[model samples]
Target: MLIDLHKATLLVIDVQDKLVPAMADPQGILARIRWLLQVATELGLPTVISEQYPKGLGATATALTDAAPQAIVVEKLQFSCVAAECLPESLLAHEQVVVCGMETHVCVLQTVLELLALGKEVFVVEDAVASRTPASREAGLRRMRDAGAQVVNREMVVFECLRGASHPRFRHISKTFLVGEQP
Candidate 1:
């Protein structure tokens, strides 16, 4: 199913400062997430950021927080963000959730499952989520897909939201974000 921008919320899961360095392709993951955040902000989509155990794992990365200063940051010890009780009412009202974050096999996977179980249409940004090992990341993506989560990339989510080149934000988003990158 195509993601509806109007009914969608962006859920940025556990991309903490302390945990990022060890993740596979940290720079690439962060760049995709930052780009996603920029697009979400421009589109005025509500965003919820989940931090897993801040005291032990540290806060969300500065770059991510800076990218979307207005995003709601929710601290949680639960692997599944749903259990954190941190999702904002505005975001919870949305029917579709676009998720991007770290450790695909653990936090991200569990969160996607929970979101799906909640009857929300879940989309996992494959490129934006990562694990320390390629195997784990692949397994997580596979399992999420098997569990009915749509596995998508950053460009797919952006362009799908835009729908057409004639869209007002299309030119700006394409020129600024999609430039030098293939969808």
Candidate 2:
């Protein structure tokens, strides 16, 4: 199924400063997420960011904060963001949710599951999320897929949201964010 850009919202889950270094390929994950956030901004999509527990986990990484300055940042102790009741009604109104963040096995996995249960067409950006162990990350991806979330990569989302090369922002987004990157 195609992700309808008009009905989509981006959910940036728990990419906290203290937690990022422990994840596999921290830099690469952050880069993809930043690129996704940039595309979301250019497309005028609303973004909701969640911090697992700022007091303990640290704030959202500076890179992400700079990338999505206008994103609604919610701090919560719940692993599943839905359970935190932090997502604004405006964001929840969107039928499609694209999730990207840290600890794929924990926060990302739970959030995707709950979003799916809520009837939202959820897409997890695989390359934009990571876990400290490859085993956990793979398991989380499998579980999310088994539970009904469409597992996608960042590039697929970017182009899908753009729809076609003829889109007005297509050239700009491609050049600025997707350059030298393979899908």
Every model's TM-score = 0.96, 0.96
Candidate 2: give the clashing pairs. none
**CA-lDDT, candidates in order:** 0.90, 0.90
lDDT tens per residue, model 1, 62-97: 999998998999999888888777777888789999
RMSD of 2: 1.3
Instruction: Note each model's CA RMSD in angstroms.
Output: 1.4, 1.3
Candidate 2, after superposition: displacement of residue 56 in Å? 1.0
Question: Positional deviation of 130 in candidate 2, in angstroms?
Answer: 0.7
Question: Which stretches in model 1 have alpha-carbon errors above 4 Å?
Answer: 181-183
What is the C-alpha lDDT profile of model 2 across 137-172, one tens digit per residue? 999999999999999998889889999999999999
State the displacement of the C-alpha of residue 54, model 2, in Å, after optimal TM-score superposition: 0.1
Off by over 4 Å in 2: 181-183
